[model samples]
Target chain A: MVFICSVATAQLPINWIDPLNEGVLQGRLADNDITGYNRLPDSVKSVVREPVWALGTNNAGVYVNFKTNAKEIQVRYTVSGALDMPHMPKTGVSGLDLYASNNNGEWYWTPGDYRFKDTITYSFGPVKENSHRIYRLYLPLYNTVTWMEIGVSSDATIEFQKEEESPIIIYGTSIAQGGCASRPGLAWSNLLGRALNTPVINLGFSGNGRLEKPIIDLIANTPSRVIILDCLPNLTGVTPENTERIDSLIQAAVYQLRASQPNTPIVLTDHSSGFNKNILDETDNTLYEQTTQAGLASFEKLKQAGVKNLYHLRNADIALDINSTVDYAHPNDFGMVKISDAYQRLIEQFLR
Target chain B: MVFICSVATAQLPINWIDPLNEGVLQGRLADNDITGYNRLPDSVKSVVREPVWALGTNNAGVYVNFKTNAKEIQVRYTVSGALDMPHMPKTGVSGLDLYASNNNGEWYWTPGDYRFKDTITYSFGPVKENSHRIYRLYLPLYNTVTWMEIGVSSDATIEFQKEEESPIIIYGTSIAQGGCASRPGLAWSNLLGRALNTPVINLGFSGNGRLEKPIIDLIANTPSRVIILDCLPNLTGVTPENTERIDSLIQAAVYQLRASQPNTPIVLTDHSSGFNKNILDETDNTLYEQTTQAGLASFEKLKQAGVKNLYHLRNADIALDINSTVDYAHPNDFGMVKISDAYQRLIEQFLR
Candidate 1:
């Protein structure tokens, strides 16, 4: 095992694994798709529905019975990304749905029902935690999935050392919060999590997402693999002064975070679509472009000043065209998918 | 004066002659343009600072200054379209700004301001009671400038007489309640009012727009030129049964309203965009498309059943593309302008 040391004198073991470059395979499949059954047994359905009705999780578990014989496996996923959070369900939703195939072709089911909770750890059957070959984890929500730490066993024969838990943090306004996602899993962030197979923390506030210091301070405390900054749509009619202030605020936050976690990656994102068109001359487009450019410049300046982990996602033509929007500015689900896919690609290519 | 009594019992008088459309000639100077003057006077600057602070009947005095001998004029404005009776500001904002001018330069300007307290007659200038020759009503906050009734003084003069004072009524969820319009004038309904140069009573209840019978009843009591329905976006995961129930509720309301205002126009609008492209498959798109088609069919039934004034704004391509949206659903300012412009064009051609 390689132990990395931080530049700051604070003595803490640093587990720095390159999330962007590492060989990680993450994905998800719905229960019915995997199990070929639409409804769980009445008893299981009652149990699942009990919690579902008590408190809806944006992406809640849809039970699946695995029927495979693979031996050992590792899994990763992101819980949330750029989707709106308020609309996402909070309690009663389990993160991952894990199923195993013990008696092939015979019915595969859990021995007993487990109550949903914020955190839980478990080992299945006689299989060593590290040696279990075939397993599945159900992810029914977006934005709240914090980490994809591996489940391990003490036995040396079955090696299951949890990977470094550095998360991708998304910061933005309502869209980041998961607005209009009919279900939690449908949010782009969750979709991205399914695509990249990594843990993600959603920090998207509804209308309160301004690049303020307090929020930044909270974010800096998190051990993040990457930080995505997407704001400005909420700052409509914002003048240069306010934009400058926000830029500086972001810069200060990044610097503070860097002081603690030196090479943690940071990616700055701009407001997508709607504001780029020439609806009323170039005023709206110019301002949006200027603010975005200024933000990128600030990030670049930080990089020049020796902040090694910083990048920016430039405005894309697909996101700027008129057809990209549902109304004018807000992305429809299609747009969300496009953005999420873009972020995932960028992170894989650059931050990794 | 020609008072043509039609088959409908409502007996609405139609004198559809618009001054702005009568080759009245517009000037190069726009209302909001900053050309010619390097800087505005202190008073103008101060007023511009709180452009939308004062509104409704109480602040009618402020709009008086917009009247000038200029051919075209532009003004920054904001107006709340939510009805005053059940006084509450909707969660989102909507508005617009545009330049209005007359070629003769003889048009009188008296920043006309008035609130709709119950009902009040609006006559511009000293052209006697209902004798204005050519009047242009500019609603900056509403992003609409329309020509009101003309030709009360002479037969050759173009005239627009309000036979019935029923306004164009809108019913829907948050979008209908005016989400993220930057200002009030940009709302599609408000823009429609400006295009028609007529009074519009907004009954948009934010999240509470559920197509309830009471709301339909409330709208039915008022005199209305048309009814615009846009509500599916708010019904996120409603079951087919609920959708049918809502549709029935709308039909009931329409039935009652048509019974009273027989020939009044009715326009039904469907959800713009919601399907996230990444997750979009044949099933989801088919479901959404089917819902919209069903909605259109229901509206058409009313038209076929002796309702001559019924229309439907097709859903395909009506909403700005998913990319233009700020989130997956709500429209940004640019999206709002696009939608409003589309409605304006549609109404112009249809109402003609």
Candidate 2:
């Protein structure tokens, strides 16, 4: 825990890669929407707000792997716009967040402000400087990446590690997309990726994770070791009036994934109570009850229909106590970590 | 921690107040700024974004005294607008957050979903419902409190408590105003207010806490047990180029406060490092260095000039770990709590 007051900034030669470039991206898609590789569908994209659509474009679940001999490293990138909102901190705007790890499989933010914006460049020596194991760095979670590159000492050996061909994929709400987190790497999905020691895919659509047919098609088509659907909060939307819609959405998504990737285990998660119902608004109470009930009922229906390789996670399992959420709906970093605790364990069973 | 599954909605009499109403407010000023009783000045009000100014109007540092013998209570409030932003959560948007404590001076949110929205109400039982005690509730942080009221069971008693006269006053930036806190009560300022067992004043103007003369005039005029100027982070921006402005702001603020209230101790806090300078963006690093240097230099100037009742807090006092912020600047709940921890200690000195 010794913090040096001042340290010399190392001079080094570096290799850089533009992740949005063809053949360079791995894990998640950068250009899934119709607007020439934007993250959201041009239609559904308009349905959401500006900040959300902008956040959806961030390479949250995406990562880059490069092996370098030199201990010191630097990363640089730019965002489309560093639009500063009064309510949100600048870090969540266009901040180029970084996360790295050695062979030990533990991830840490390079020493500095994990959230930055306007222009992005972070340089730091690895914890194990001498060993040149593969390192992973996640991009922003709440802004669009216009350009990014990696740097290392000129003479150091540098190579990009191959992407994980079969990775665990999580499809859910903003928590899955990394909402209000200080940086991209802190999201539950990304944390699970680091913990499980496997590549993971994040197809989380902020405010639009309603298990639409279009989204399920995309998730089912992806090469995944396991598929997780944690969209109950976004699905029920404070009402059970449309019981058929709730039942059909999950039922259809489950069958679609099974039809495409029959061997890959698909897990459905019930609504995680973001607030204590004991002291909540009537709407929130209704939302909690309807969403969880709908999720459980749909899970039962799927089980009765002999859906193989299917599992269910109850809402109460996570047990996030009071004040864990950033808002009632979004989990803070601690809550996100707690969420990863559940996912890391849930997927392990299928992997074994 | 006794778990009750569900209970019938109790039939009870209710009491409520719409603080925004001209005559109903207590504690906080309804028309401090020249902008027709709003918190912000008429000119500056137009300069800042809508949400920021809207948030300024919220009843922060404001409290309503109420006595109720009812076993259970409910608070209902509606925000001016429920504008949703992606980078921040709904709680930071239009959520109506509430806090209460019994005579022990321990503040707690009235049970369930502490964060609610649009027209939402939070209901909870008192620490002990047998007798009535003075209860205090803090309003929303990032939204305008348009309409609000309180409700109680039929047989219970209820009435408004009086405002404290000579309270602790905090003058600073968005962090002081509760930026990314999931709800109102979690903000460091509110937490400090509760922890100190007294009324506290909040003059935290989002991105606008730059130590302007008008703001200083307001602080000097207010009756306070102690004065805290934590505006360094918001004052210095990213450049120390003019160092004069930073120096002048502090020197002027201290002089004004001393002239107005010579007996009240004034506390100045250095910038809490939200980011590590070693790995921060060049601009952010420059901000850290300049702000710290300017703050220290001014503190020395004040001391040399025989400014009595003056105190300065070092940055190292608050140890905020990485990922503690929603963005690198404004802290999430954990970071806010950490900030409150330091203030709770620092101000305790002046109180004694």
Candidate 3:
């Protein structure tokens, strides 16, 4: 039993690594020709509506996987939007979420001190057990990361992991894009991926997931074992006009997915308003009731029309109570877990 | 059937009511000699430590109750600190959370749009049912409200409810102070109050809840059904010095409370960290492990000395997962609910 200690006069140098160079970028359709750390490629900028194209720039479900034995890890990144919303904190909107897994395969959330400035910085330090450990760093959910660099102690070793080829792809609204979660790691899509130990491509285009033909075509090109369409919440109301539009959109989306990926399991999720909203507020009742009906009717129609492997997840399955959300629309961390648990239960069987 | 409708061109004038004048201001130990919306009386300003006195200005568990039949409801208020935090959003920090109930005694959260400017304004308009209903508006958890006004349609009726005298009083640290709840209404203390249909005094002093003698004297004066001391998180560290200080403080606080309130039940809550921290971070493990041991030892010492009807709640009883918090320390909305559920389960039995 012996111990050796050294004292240095100067600070250790930091080695910055760009994830794109070697790291595994999960929740992306392709690695080539992508302009930045965006969920969508540059080709879609001209094809989709401006709102959808702009939202595609956000790194919602994207995460980078790597292993390092660095005593301290530092993140320097720049974001293109407001750091936070009135209801959602900056940690969920624009902060990096880092998770580490040990040899026993148990994952631990590593918290860090963060500063929001011109160039936001997060310092996760003093790696307690300095052995090489697997790390997954989730990117911001609602903000565009213009650039990012991960810095480690210059003397430490580092390696990048590979992403799973077939991911569970989600095409939905803001909720699916991680609206109002306390942090990026708690987003339902991200939670599902961690629970299943698989990758998940988030194609959620906040307020613009209208089942458009162009976006569906883009989703078709993505390689996925399972696909989820959760766009009804964004297109819900009691008016006859809204009812007609949602019914048609659901029909079109299922047909479009079936045309390209015949064997992929397509899950249609109903609008998840708090289940008791029908008894609480009239405006909410009208919107959610009609949306739920339209979603179920569409799912039944698609299944009867010989669409195999088609499934429907009702709002009741998500089990969101009044306290689950930050605002009525967005799931806070509590709501995020409930939605994630529901998806994990249904989607786990499909993945296996 | 005869149907008649009347139309008026001018906007309905608003009638503003001061909550201090008539509305039930729950969570206050006494309504007299309070300077503003602070939890403590002005007399204690010079007695307690400066940090504890400063945190007392925050309206953590305070809520105003009223019944109104107004067509529109408007809230105009000013907060004296930063509108929000890096990790906790404005909805929890400085925003007013409103909840309504019907005649059938079912509660519903009313959603509204808000703007945070020089003076924050929240509009929860167009009372859909046009019936008089009870409403509870929770004040900000982390900010001081300098002035506030509630306005209703001039034509409608309004009445303030009276607060119960015997509340479940909680004196503790930041988690008790609703450090990072998404909304003030979701704070565990408030949630427990709503669950048990009782008032709850939140004496959470952020980093200053050190079981000081002066603060315990203030707690002893409050008319309470039960008193919960949950200050272990703020007093935690690994050092032998830290353990000795916490042990003595806990012992003194219990003895001090017993001197004044001979019949009241006092609950001592252990520090609540994410249960997995012991296996994850050594620094966290040391602090929590030492704190947990100190708290249990103090609880046992008090009980062995014939402290009757005393209760102790462990961290595991709260059932916080890794996903429960915003930071490693502060509980988010998910964590708040977990803590509330634990308190509700324990406190409900005693209330009966």
Candidate 4:
């Protein structure tokens, strides 16, 4: 390794590595085309719900990691979509968020505000005077990456390690898909991926993240560290009669994921909003209460039915702070960071 | 006073008064139009920077305060413009943020979420069990409010409090303008306003927050608790030849503010992004370094000139964590909260 490092420094703009080729793409969808981040398989694209497939085109929690000693890091990629919404930037434009941690330390954004746009080959360098560091590059949350390249200064060495096979799989809604955040790395799942130093499979389907069998089959195919079901928001506007529909849908997904990887933790999350029944506006809207009720009822039903290793985060505190959310529905970077904190605390027992 | 209380409860949908009409609106421009929100006064509307006046259209830290015994609080208002940026919600569209604290205890958002679009009359209620409470409604950060009405349930009462004339006046960039925040109330200025129980003058012009004579003249007229100048981000990209221009602008703004409000405190903030010179990528941008240099030079020059009551918050921690900002420039709500904490701590000696 030392001899390899000595020779690596002689080459400037150290060799660019496509993480997808290396199989360390954390949030890349399974069975994607040659490009690792096609959002979903073409076969299932027509089957998934509207806005879900289209919005799914944006890569929210996707990321790749490597070790490098170069003082500067650079990226070159083309963002495929521009769904610029006022409430959500993470899912709006073509931009990537870069994070770095040393020797498995805390992650931090590079100092020079490494966000990119028209210029794809962006460099973040003179990093804290460190000889070697682990870097995580997040894809654009609101746009798709066609192809990409990551490189470091000529004098430094870049190393790609083996990939995690049974990575954490997150299945959820738009918020889980990275809504309203400024960058993909700002999404909670990406942050958790780095925080846990584990691979993550983001099955977040934007507006179409409702509990569906076709999607469950996709999730079941992937063995996982943990399966997080954060699909309550997409299950909005349900009527009294439809409660059973939701319960059945959630049950089926759980059973599928559990059957494939029974011992792997299957964690269910309640809608961040609508959980507090005490709020006046939401209580008046029976729709809000119904949503909360449905989520809670599913958890109870699942537990009573002898579903073991089921973890329920009934009330995640990310929604507690009204300010934390970008829009009322999606969390901004601050909320994203907080969500990661909550998940890390909740899942530490299982993952760590 | 007691006689007024008797009749208030007797009436249902207790008098819903427009705080603007009640003369309780604070942080609004000194002279606004019939609607009460002036994105920019006609005089400087064109003279100011492009996004500054456009962004200024969004009310930041502007609020209305009243005491109420009603168990529910409802807001009806129309947001005029929608300058939806993919970056932040606070500065993207029009929305209101509400907060309540009783007997001067902790502050909390009313249960359930209520954001605005075109015609908006949203209610927040079934509040945490409380009889009488102090309510402060924040205007939008990136949009203008045409008109607003605050009402309560039939069984309750609402009373407006006298507005504070000598208020804490904040002058800064979009962060000061509440960028990327889920709500206006999360902005540091608004949070500080509540923490200090003082009305705030939010002159946070977005990309246009640079100190200029025309703007400084406006700030000088107000009898302020303190004048906070947070325009470092706007000063970035300054070339070596332009150091004098920056020095002159910031110095003139400070000296001018001090000239009128002789004893009032004047706080200068450093560029959050450039705080750590140790960062690798930023050192390459000499423009970034020059900007920081210009700010420090002016601060030192003023101090040597024997400027009194001038406080400086050099390298505020808001930029320390990459997660703090929604984009690289504007803070997310958590960062906003942290900024508020730091401000409350630094300004406590002066205001509290």
What's the true lDDT of residue B349 in model 1?
Answer: 62
For candidate 2, write residues A124-186 as lDDT tens digits: 554344353566666666567777767666777666676646878888887687765645667
Q: Candidate 4's residue-wise lDDT over A1-352, tens digit each?
A: 9999899666564667676677666665564452457656676666777676676666777666777777777788766665465456432356666776666465557633444455455566556556455677777776777778887766667776546577888888877887766667667888788778777878787777888876777778777788898888888767766787778888888888888887989888877765443233444335655776887898899999999999877554454555566445676667778788888888997665
**Better-scoring candidate (TM-score), 1 or 4:** 4
* i-RMSD of all predictions: 16.4, 7.1, 2.4, 4.5
Question: Per-residue alpha-carbon lDDT of model 4 for B1-352, expressed as tens digits?
Answer: 8999998657464556777667667676564542366645677765666676666666777777777767667778887675465555423446666677667566656633454446665566655556556777777787777777887776666777656468777778877887767567777888787777667888887777888766787788878888888887787766665778778887888888888989998888876655543233545345555677788888999999999998877564444566666545666666778787777777887764
Docking class of 3: medium
Q: How should the candidates be ordered by DockQ, best one leading?
A: 3, 4, 2, 1
User: What is candidate 3's lDDT per residue for A276-325, written digit by digit as tens?
Assistant: 65234556656777888877877888888889999888789997887888
In terms of lDDT, the poorest run of 10 residues in model 1 chain A is A30-39
lDDT (10s digit) by residue, model 1, range A1-352: 1333344433333222222222232221111212111111222333332432122222332222222222222334343333222112221122333433222321121111222333433223322332223333334433334444432222222211222456677766666655433333435565565456555655555455566655565567667778777765555444767667666866887788778777777877776743442222234455566666666667777778877767776667235443233334444344556678788888898655
lDDT of 1 by residue, B246-325 (tens): 56865876787788778777777766653433211233344555566557667777777766677777655465643233
Cα TM-score per model:
0.36, 0.62, 0.95, 0.77
lDDT of 3 at B239: 77
- lDDT of all the models against the reference? 0.44, 0.66, 0.83, 0.70
Ordered from best to worst lDDT, the candidate numbers read: 3, 4, 2, 1
Looking at model 1, residue B247 earns an lDDT score of 65
lDDT of 4 at B350: 78
Fraction of the true interface contacts (Cα pairs closer than 8 Å across chains) found in each model: 0.00, 0.14, 0.47, 0.51
